[model samples]
Target: MSSLRSSELDGDSDDSQLAAKFWEVKLPDVVPLDDLKAIEKTQAAEVIQRAWFSHMDKIIFQLLKHTICAAENCVTHEILKKVCPSEAALVKDPSVQCKVRFRFGGKNFPPFIVFKIFLHTGGHGNKYFSGKNTLRPSSEAVVDACKLMGNRKYYDQIIQDQLQFQKYKVADEVDVVTMKDYMHFTSFLDETPAYLGGKSNCWRRLSLENFPKTMIMYDIMDYATSGTLSDRLQKELKYLLQKPKSKEMHHDQLRIVSQVRHWG
Candidate 1:
């Protein structure tokens, strides 16, 4: 019995349970709203635009596709490094910009994470370059990339226009927006009636005299980004755990299965 117990612990330690709990506590670290405007201010427009260009599609696809690939590069890479270091290392290289290849509909999407044209070589001949994760491009690089990419570019135009009306939107849409309503609209992926005009108590006008629009979007994006990742990882890990562990149902299997059959 002692030898058997030891063998069981060695075979299936169930590391994922700890991982799931770890995820709950780990998500909020990256959602610093106060820092977003600072990020925008410090980052160049071009680099931001390029980061969006390279990684936005992947982000959207992952969200809409699996709905759980929510971890931003910084978080995802760290977690992945713990779970699968070899895979994480591929994209962590400063020189190697990473793009998530989506294999769906019998098609393939290649890696696209690149923001600048230049590359850096580390001391040990490792190629170190910035913009490996374009979505989170360094602020200065964003500005530089945007200038190089051009002013009338679609992304720049859209962001510029959006920032102009941010003050109005915050006053009319965000600041007064209640927590419940915000959760409903965002968590449900509400898009039909439109959040601002939607017919729900969750949508109400609150005084934004003290609210800053820049601060609001910054906070909103951080939540959206990190929450998405936490939700995704949990869902996938749960699905994996519930899968049957064996093909046969022997007498011993039945006894083992019945002993602690709470999981799946």
Candidate 2:
């Protein structure tokens, strides 16, 4: 009876070990391949999102510091270098001049910030300085500005005021008889231009309304030069302008005119 009991106990032990080995082999097979892939993709996306947020946070911090310096009227070369080291380095050349403009609110307007960089050759009415300048507080900057202001309503009011101001300024500069005529001349056609499609028009109109006219013009010119614009559009504009060099000039002129249009 004792021998029989020992043999039975050994048999039970062997069964338990086999069961453990079977489960170990089947565990991986039980998890779906799709689930494993999904887990990997999620992990990758999380890593990318974390990197993007970290980058944006640094930009916001720098913008906030620059704003504070501007508000205090203590923005200097040293401060600018600290705030934007890369831009400062670019402007270190003697030919480049940097100007910082700030607008604080009164009863009519809210605060705004602008940075302009242009070529300075110590001459009057030079072609280089005409429209060859960098203007900042871009659309991205505007979003950052809204964040800094802590009030979207005020920022919206500020944008409206800026739109009005730009219109009046253009009219006064060009001696336009009325804003109505200006808008009529720049009006969107009933059909999209052959060079641009419906999708391009949609985005262009949205950009025109939301961003500064000069910046939009610069971007458009860049697109045209970089071949980002449609081949047909480039060919047509080049033919009409008669000179490839004049494309930028024409765009700049249009920019001034379009600034007055009430798209938004």
Q: Could you say which candidate leads in lDDT? A: 2
**Could you tell me how far off, in angstroms, the CA of residue 37 lies in candidate 2 after the best superposition?**
1.9
Per-residue accuracy of model 1 over 87-204 as CA lDDT, tens digit each: 5687677667554332223133422121111223444443212232232345876688678868777365446436534643432223336776545534222221332222221211
Give me candidate 2's TM-score against the actual structure.
Answer: 0.22
- Model 2, C-alpha of 48: deviation from truth (Å): 1.4
Per-prediction TM-score to the true structure, in the order listed:
0.16, 0.22
How does each model score on lDDT? Answer: 0.38, 0.42
- Evaluate residue 174 in candidate 2 and report its C-alpha lDDT on the 0 to 100 scale: 36
User: What residue runs in model 2 are displaced by over 4 Å at the alpha carbon?
Assistant: 1-29, 74-264
Residue-by-residue lDDT tens digits, candidate 2, 147-183: 7767866456457545544654431223345777555
